[model samples]
Target: MAKEIKKVVLAYSGGLDTSIIIPWLKENYNNCEVIAVSGDVGQGTELDGLEEKAIKTGASKLYIEDLKQEYIENYIWPCLKADAKYEDYLLGTSHARPCIAKRLVEIAKAEGADAICHGCTGKGNDQVRFELAIKAFAPDMKIIAPWREWSIKSRDEEIDYAEAHNIPLKINRETNYSKDKNIWHLSHEGLDLENPANEPQYNKPGFLELGVSPEQAPDEPTYVTIHFEKGIPTAVDGEELGAVELVTKLNKLGGANGIGLLDIVENRLVGMKSRGVYETPAGTILYKAHNVLETITLDKETFHYMQSQIAPKMADLTYNGQWFTPLREAIGAFVDKVNENVTGDVKLKLYKGNVINAGVTSPYTLYDEEIATFDEDEVYDQKDSAGFINLFGLPIKVQAKLKAKNSAE
Candidate 1:
């Protein structure tokens, strides 16, 4: 016997898995009233007709929350400031999950729901991300993961179940990929992407949603200038814009030049390796520009330490759905302090998927031309290096002398 659930709030995306989840929850949870919640993190037209679809599919009501500005300013900017990337992959989907789940919990509470449900599959990392976030926000809320409990074995089976229940679906058996899209990035998985040996069909029409293939990009290169204030982007190409507008503009420029495309076999939190293709467009360009600016703005020790130590850990924490944890908040504080002087502009040339660093300029730059130049300077004498080298090599010189003395003896 299962515990009775009267009502449930679902984190709906109007995607295939979520499309049928409304019906599945009502069928299994004693006909519980389902309230659908969708976070609009720059998914654009995907949210169009979502309310009608949700109502038709048995949801009592649909809440489409506009989280675009919040997603970029709070979530995306923090990740950028920390320079968080998992295995060289821009953590687009990983960070977006927490933002969506947080909003879902809020809606669940407001709706007076007994439980929160999601369409995340048992085998994927999303289930862990969603559940961990929900647990952090509302520990007492019951989590109902249909994929873990239901008997559906494959996507084909899920489609059949949806058809039998007359649940309208936007996908069919011919659907070749499982994709998640937001303002930050777009990810593609399943289908031919499952086999690591198969090369992605980048040339195929409709293969990429964010940008064209590098091969299809124009021959002429496009130049972009990104301005930053304390590690947050403020403008592009001399046009000052807000967080959302800046990213949207960059996405268009970078995508047109075929800038941000990646295919990798990444390790999932569930202890399995999965292949995914990602189109980051704007994110890739932004990360590049921010990093270049940091090169000039941050001191040697802090910059090197951030790149060597803080970045990887930050990436892991973000990817693991620990955004609400105190540790992540502390890390954010550290990143914020480090970014106090990271105000600058970076110019780049986008050509055939390459972000070439054209130049970087900053008022806080620590680089001293006179000190670094080869010509004679009044700052100091080059001869001072002799004494410094002698002292620095003293231990090595002593060890060598002792070895020689012992060998002779």
Candidate 2:
């Protein structure tokens, strides 16, 4: 049995699921009042008219919180500094959920709501993400997940319910794909994407919202210089921009060049394999540029260790919705320490479906041209390598001699 609830705050996006959930909660929760809250992480016009629609559906009031700058600075930049990528994914959707959920909790507390609601399905990873984050912030708040408790089994049935209740929805039964978009990236799932064998139709109209196909990209390449301060991208093409503006600018540039399109079947935290088509135009560009700067700035051991160990761990934590965990915070501190010297400039050429590194420079670069020169220099002695190699290969030579002696016997 569920606990009695009076007021519920819903994390609403005005999407198909969330649109229907407002009425469903009222019906199931004994006519409880529903206050809709939408977090604006650069969804552009998606929030337009959301207030009217939310109220028309069943919500008492709607709050659209502009979290774009906070989302970029707090969530996106830390993941970027950690170099976190889930498999081949740039983790655009993964990193946004916690920020949205955190805000939802805040609103619920301010409204004095006893319960919170989200539209995430039982089969997806988002339910866990939303619920865990809510628990972290407000442990006693009741969580209502419609998909888990309601009898509605499919989107088709949800559409029927919406029609019977006179609820307006932007998506219908014929909707080809389900999409989630923010400033950093846009993700596409469902429809033809359910079958991994079918190749994505990027050329098809409306299939891709953020970028054109590489074939459709301009013939000539475009060059952009990215400036980073402490591993966070600060500017593009020598123009200083804030976090949101920087990502927005790169999205347009990289999208024009068809730089970030990925078709991947990834393992969900719920122990299911799901296929998704992701467009991470700006994220793809920044990751490449930041990595190049790290190569020049970070010492050999730190760079190798980060690549081999820290990065994958961070990726796992972020992908699993463990952003609020202490381990993530500790790792973030270490990542920040590593990024202190990562300030630099990286030049990249954006061609069809490629972000090619053109140049990189940093004030804190560890590269020594004089010592690394092919010609003889005062910094190094050629004869020193002979002794070094002898010592380095001593164990190998001894093992070989022992093997030879044993073979002869």
Candidate 3:
């Protein structure tokens, strides 16, 4: 026996699962008014006519909040600065969840709703990300997870529910390849992807929005220059752009050259391994370019130290849904300090899916052409290496000498 919920703000996406949740919530909660809150984070056409669809499916009202800029600047930029890639994933979908869930909480408070709901499946990591974000933001707010509570077990059941309730869905959209998209990246799962051994068909219908198959890419090389200021990308190809636009511009260029396609079997936070193919054209370019700049700007010790923590910190923060936590904030401060002189231009050559670094330059570059030149220069004395090597290898020499003395005795 659960307490009665008068109203709930559903984090709706106008997708199959969310479309059904509207009617399902009403039925379970004695016909409660479900207010749909759709956070638009560069989902493109997915937001088209969302309000009408929500209202027709039994939602009392719909709130379409444009969170694209906030999503890019607040969420995406922080993760990018931290180089936060979960298990080598750019975390496009994982990072966006917290922003969405936080917005859901804001909508819940604004609407004075009794509970907040999301359409995450019980078997997936998103449920944890979404719920934990909700908990962090609104500790007292009731969370209604339909997948965990309701009897609707599969996509078939959800589609059936949608039909019975006369909820309009995109009939042409193929359900074979389940996908999630945002400005940063697009993730593909389900269908043939469920089996790890099955080779992904680039020719699969409805696939390849951000990239052509590597085989289909142009044979010619494409070069693009990315400009950075204090580690954050400010412009691409001389055009100053905002966070979303910058990513969008780079995604187009990277995809044209078959740049950012990754197939990996990753450890999900829910204690399971899932295989997914991710296309992160813009993210890939940014990552490679940023690292190139940091090479010249960051000291060897600091760079290596931060490099060691990049993966683990990314996994813990992204997986645990602590995108806005103090720990992440502290890490960001350190990363920012490391990027102080990361200001520079990186020219990368994209050829048949490979992003090869062409050239890099920075005002703070520690590389001295005169000192590093192959030709002779008056910069240093070569004989100094004798004393330096002796000092450097002193401990090893002493240990070896002791071993020889002991053997003789």
Could you say which candidate leads in lDDT?
A: 2
- Give the local distance difference test score of model 2: 0.92
User: Quick one: ranking by TM-score, best first?
Assistant: 2, 1, 3
Worst 10 residues of 1 by lDDT: 167-176
Q: Give, for candidate 2, the lowest lDDT window spanning 10 residues.
A: 169-178
For candidate 1, what is the TM-score?
Answer: 0.97
Ranking of all candidate structures by their lDDT, best first: 2, 1, 3
- In the order shown, the candidates' Cα RMSDs to the true structure are 1.3, 1.2, 1.7
Candidates' lDDT values, in order? Answer: 0.91, 0.92, 0.85
Candidate 3 achieves a global lDDT of: 0.85
TM-score per candidate, chains pooled: 0.97, 0.98, 0.95
- Clash counts for all predictions: 0, 0, 0
lDDT of 3 by residue, 1-409 (tens): 2347988999999988898999898888988889999988878888899999998889999999888889888887777766767778888888889989998998899889999999988878888888888988899999998998998887877778888888888742355466787888888888778899998777665688888877888989999999999889999878899887898899988998888999999988778889999999989999899989988888889888777886469557886677677787788787778778889899999988899999999999988888888889899778999999999999999999999999999
Q: At residue 230, what lDDT does model 2 achieve?
A: 94
lDDT of 2 by residue, 222-328 (tens): 99999999999998999999998899999999998998999999999999999999999999999999999999999999999899889999999888889899999
Candidate 3 C-alpha error for residue 249, in Å = 0.8
